[model samples]
Target: MPLDAESDAIGTLLLERGALSAEQLVAAEDLAEGWNVSLVQVLLARRWITLQDLYEQIAIYHDLPLVDLEADPADDTLVRRYDPAVMNRFSTLPLHESDGTITVATSRPGPRTLLHIRDLYGPRSRIVVATHLQISAALQKAFRDRHSHDAVFALAEQDPDMSAQQVVTPPQILVLYVLLSVLLAGVAFAPVPTLIALNIFLTVFYTGNFLFKGLLVWIGGAAQETSSRAIAAGAALLREEDLPVYTVLVPMFREPEVLPILAQALRNLNYPLAKLDIKIVLEEGDHDTIEAAERLDLEGVFEIVRVPPSHPQTKPKACNFALRYAQGDFLVIYDAEDKPEPDQLRKVVAAFQQSSPDTACIQCRLNYYNARENWLTRMFTLDYSLWFDLMLPGLERMGVPIPLGGTSNHFRIDVLRDLNAWDPFNVTEDADLGIRLTQKGYRVGVIDSTTYEEANVSIPNWIRQRSRWIKGYMQTFLVHSRRPVHLWRSVGAAGVFGFVFFIGGTILSGLLNPVFWAIFGLWMIFGAAAIEPFFPLPVLYLSLVNLLAGNGLLIYLTMVAPFRRRWTDLAPWGVTVVGYWVLMTVAAYKALWQLISNPFYWEKTQHGLSKHTASELAEAKAGGPEALAAAPMPETGP
Candidate 1:
């Protein structure tokens, strides 16, 4: 039969077998033609039939035998005839050899693959049917002996700077120490001149940082104003067959309580089941989470990837290991507690299609589900709203490097691998990867979608989470700044400035807030007479202005952040921004200490602690998948 005839025959067979209805088959055919993809791919993507079933039907149609690689291992000598890479690329494996003739198992035994097989194995080579899973497993087994080591773990040995290990260079340490020593000496000896100079520098720095952030907030608001315009004009429903395979990696540790909820949330995604490759990555020794996952007995769409116990033991490391097994054109990471909007994947696909090829990443906005859990949750929500809702979009608009949020970051699989995936040793791999992507000349964009997560409601948990983040930021700054000229050339002036302010300012603000507060308190209580010599008129005025205006502007940004999300009631609680800064200061100090001591320690934040889980779950169930797709896209201000 002709190629087109065979393709049409397969569709006919599937319909005859009751695998697909007439309407679904027509829709699949239309999508296949529109997207320029194969009819088999469209059918598989739509989940009309399982891979096994599809291959089974194909075998019957062609009068071939069905072979299961798992049940029947391939002959070693026959497999050795072909290179593993060739076999993997073509999705074929040699099944057996008899009387100088070879039989091969292939999920896709198309003309091109068959030609290659015949070229290598001679005209006598015959074809057999096998599921994709079997072919993948056979390839893994074939390469297992030669490629047993995980790529992510080996990255540290290959490029120490790129890995999380040895992040802070010796020169950076020396530079920091010398600066601190000089500052202390000046404060002790030449207090008058030192205080005046220091105050002047800080005043300018604070003003720049404040104005930059305020501008972003303004731009973000404007972007939001026009967001609806774009949505209504360009938004269209995505066809199921047209959607590509999307891989979701959910990395979990000891948190077992949220497994059921996480599973349910993922299952509710609107994408076709067959096109969704969801991997729940867990540490090998995390028996609690492992057991919880097993108890859920998630459907075939979900797979459990147990990462071997290794150094760094970070979430990115786990993701990197799992990256090798992902079978998708695009991928996204979700935290265990994350409840992403259902249509987020479709939105990302649209964003990717609309964007340039250099745009390798799309970051979705994140908010807390239990925003009103407590004072800490409220503050966390406010901070998150300001960062994701306003700051990130502003950064994207300016083409500055973005620091990716830990979850809901979608990436092109090929680009992600070419960039060597994530830094296993870096505590903040996501942020580090984001910078690296920009430095490599790839663009990261922000989409209008959102993913809801549980906020760290407990003070202790908040500190642990915040400190780890701060430490990671510090690590990213040090790693990227090692070669200043290269970074400048790579990211350009705007990128360089954005990195300094976004990464450096975030770290310094937390560390410097307490010091300024202490100085202000002492001056207010004991009068300025004792320190009169240190504060000349200009320095005094600048310090007072920064103390009053800089902090107030930040508080105001937080206040307006909630209004974007229609959380008007919580907007009033932004007054607690001062207290939030105090808590951040504590975390900052802890982060500094950890950076000097145990830099790579991942302080796990306990989740599923909120008492509102039941309500959140009920809401999710009530809203269903369509609710998330139908929800308005948040205005990303210009």
Candidate 2:
């Protein structure tokens, strides 16, 4: 057969053997061209043919020996002839060496790879056909030691300066403590002036923060209108064979109650089953979840990766370890209780195809499934709706850096690896990664897809979750601010402004909220004349406007959140969002204490605590795409 016919021979054989229908072959061919992947890969990804079927066809076509790495392992001495990186790059393994000829097993033994092999082992080299999985397994075993180390945490371990958990530098802490001491001394000796100065500074700060937040909300609303129009135009469709492999990493702690439900939700995704790579990352110490997962007897595509116990056991660290074993071209992260839309993966695939290459990540919206469970859940749902639906889209529209939501973030595997994956020490690894990507000249976009999660209904659980988030935000702010000039150069002036206001302002607002609330309360209740002198006309006006309009705008934003979801029944509760902020203040103080005392400690948030989990899971399983289609837009009430 001609060289061109040789490449097409496998497809022809598959068709002849009745393994693939004529229509499937034609569709796969078209997809192979579009995706720039081989016909076998397309067929395997679509599950049109089994690995054994493809291997048999390839062996017949190539006239080479077939090897199964699992049954007949490669000789370690032969494998050691080439570096692991080179082996991975070529997708080939050295099987054996004898009589000055080295035998190599490869899935794609094309002329180019053959010639490369000949160049490495001279003209006497022999080639063999092997399944991709076999070659991958062989290579993995050969490089087991090298692959054991987590690339995600390697940078931080090598350079302590890069660790995000070290929120404040020693020098910074010293200066801050010294300044606080001086301020307290001044308060003791010169109370009036100190109080007046503090009030003036805080008033201006609050006013600026209020205006900045208001601007984001306004821009977000406008962006939502434009996005709706774009969505109305319809999205691009992806053929079954053109859909690439997608790896999903779900890090779980001791919450085994939701494992079965989580498995069902993932299986419900509207994608090719053969192309899904879902890894359930569990801590080594959490044998209960591991046992639960084992009991489920998950499908071949679903795997449970037990992470070895280490210092500062964190979700990101678990993700980092699992990432090393991922084989997909694209990947995403999901939380334990998350029930993403069935078409979310398809949406992300289409979004990536439509976006520029520089768009490294796409963040999907997150809302609570148990929004109506209780008052806390309602508020939690509103907060998510506002942040994901409005603020993130606006930031994407304006080309500003977005702090990624913890879940539903789709990423290109190559880009993610190039950026060193996630910061294991950053509690909000997703958020830190978003900034790091931007800093490296990559952009993050917002998608229309949504994932439903169980909101923490109990106040204590909510506080634990919220405080970790606040602490993470604090860490993100401090890490990025370490080199202001470099950050500005990377993201430009507008990006810098957005980061400071969005990230820095968020942390500062949480920390300073109680102080301002106290002053307002004292002014209202005491009618203190001494306080009047401290608040001059301008300061007094700004403070009053911030207290009234700023808060009113916040409440209005909360109300708007429910409108997107068409949950009008919850809109009336937006007024009660102020009480929610009070709760946030409590969490913020707790976060502050943790930040100072135990910055690296991860306070685990208990999931599966919502009363509506059973109902939501049932709805999710029954509803599928139809339910998601009828679902209202997400609304965050923060």
Candidate 3:
């Protein structure tokens, strides 16, 4: 009954029961010591034996009864009294209480857990064994409604100013009404003057937008190189025992086919598997993905969190629900089709260590693996290279609030929870959270790591995805700009200006491009004489400069974006970016319409459409999980 003897006996029992090979047990014991974890954890992480078999042996070793929760469910009222999060952390549930004594069920029924159960329930408590998954299911079933409500409205209740629950506030509507009235009055009284004034304002804005973006690229490019090298070096020196427990939330809905891809990618990470708290957050109604995930037989580090159905079914909502049960110092979000570089998490941890104490979030770069699939994929890759690889770092350097990309952003779990997690009503919850963090005096940093994803190869799919993004930007702008003075005081003057030129510019350019294109087309068809009255010589010259210079800068920036990765082949494709802009214009209009009609609808982008998907899956299956984990990290640069 001694501690060391019990530990040794557990291994002996597994070997005697034929649960694991002697060779495997020896390796697992060695790893448990090096990892500073339990031998059971090492064996579970390595998937050397089934959870049922492992628990059966443990029950035999401890001389305790192993009860199947599915056959005899826990008392709902008893389980409901305790916090689900606490229950999950301890993996214990109150099964029965009588005569001042409590009967507790747990998948992990060791001395420490027994002590915890006694502390939570009473001095005289009986222990019964159940799988961790069984206890988790009981807790979820007991607290589904409460957790669901909190996930959807926690930000709205806790921090109304940051939530998008109110799509357009009263003050915002008033400002729009006043601006429209003024424009109508001017046009009625002095058409030509009003027209000239409008032209001047838009031309100046166009010039400022162009200059600001060019500046961002210049600063961001330099920052990426320097910061990346430092983070990579620091990560290389990190020891396994020194690494903290990390929680990864992969929220997917009905994407069954790509589940294996994400599972393999997570396994391929360089971090210790035993230290990972992985949750595959799925909607309760998504039976296909749920069944598919179950069939995969993922390691003990992985768990499936079924989110109860709710209105405004978005990724943020699911993640918010999952956040409650997350048991880690740090947390990150990845999509179903993502394949992050193996050392990305290590680089993020290093970045956080090197950052200021106030740094609450770290964003990584995103690119597409199938960049050469087609013209659209190539353009999409360039866009991401500029935004994540270049623009985001520039924002970090200049103290501007960043709008986070959809995936691969890591956060401090405490800060994230203190901020009420993500707003379920905002389609672009990640971006909105970034700004909110800055307003609350927390810094957001960007690193050089990349998570390659499946780019939208089909034009319609691309439109659906882009429109939702644009609409989310619209919502973010509206929510933040409701009280301009409050925003300015909170984020400061420079942050306010950056917000305007970055977030505001994205929304306006999309809505305004077609009108300007029409004007240019008219002039091309019928000489300047046809449009002379609309443009005075001074205004006309400025308009010409805005058109030519702005477009040229965009094309040039796109061309140079891919050069950081030595993707010289993509440089030529950047010249065709004008067509890409036109598609954006279309998406922008669709986004505008949706903002008016259906604001919170998340347009799901169909994944696994790339020609490369089949080949990637084949390669993953052929190489096996062990092979993928042992493979060398991908080189990030020339």
Backbone Cα, N, C clashes tallied per candidate: 11, 7, 0
Q: Candidate 2, TM-score vs. the true structure?
A: 0.81
lDDT of 1 by residue, 1-638 (tens): 12376668888898998887899888877766665566776665554566676787888877788887778899766686677656766778888888988888887776787788888777898889887656766665565433335544566665566665776679877998999999999999997788778877876787788888998888877665465345423435666657888899999998886766777677667666557788898887899888977765455557777776666778888898778778789999999888787777877887787778899999999998778878998899899999999999999888789999999999999999887788877888899999999988999988788898888879999999999999999989988888789899999998899898889999988988877788788899999985567777777787788888877898899999988878888888998899998899999999999998998788888887787665544554567434433443222211
Instruction: Write one digit per residue (lDDT tens) for candidate 2, span 560-611.
Output: 8767767788888899998999888888889889888888788999887766
In terms of lDDT, the poorest run of 10 residues in model 1 is 629-638
Report how far off residue 131 is in candidate 2 (Å).
7.0
Superposed on all Cα atoms, model 3 deviates from the true structure by an RMSD in Å of: 2.2
Q: What TM-score, over all chains together, does every model reach?
A: 0.84, 0.81, 0.96
| Error of model 2, residue 381, in angstroms | 0.5
Candidate 2, backbone clash total: 7
For candidate 1, the C-alpha RMSD (Å) to the true structure equals 4.7
Ranking by TM-score: 3, 1, 2
**Pairs in steric clash, model 2:** 382-636, 382-637, 383-636, 383-637, 385-635, 385-636, 386-636
Give the Cα-based TM-score of candidate 1 against the true structure: 0.84
Off by over 4 Å in 1: 1-89, 93-105, 109-112, 119-130, 134-150, 153-163, 184-192, 224-228, 237-241, 255-260, 285-301, 614-638
The 0-to-1 C-alpha lDDT of every candidate, in the order given, reads 0.80, 0.79, 0.88
Q: Tell me, what's the RMSD of every candidate? A: 4.7, 5.0, 2.2
lDDT string for model 3 (268-383, tens) is 88998888999999999999999999988999889999999989999999999999888789999999998888899999999999999999999988998888888999899999
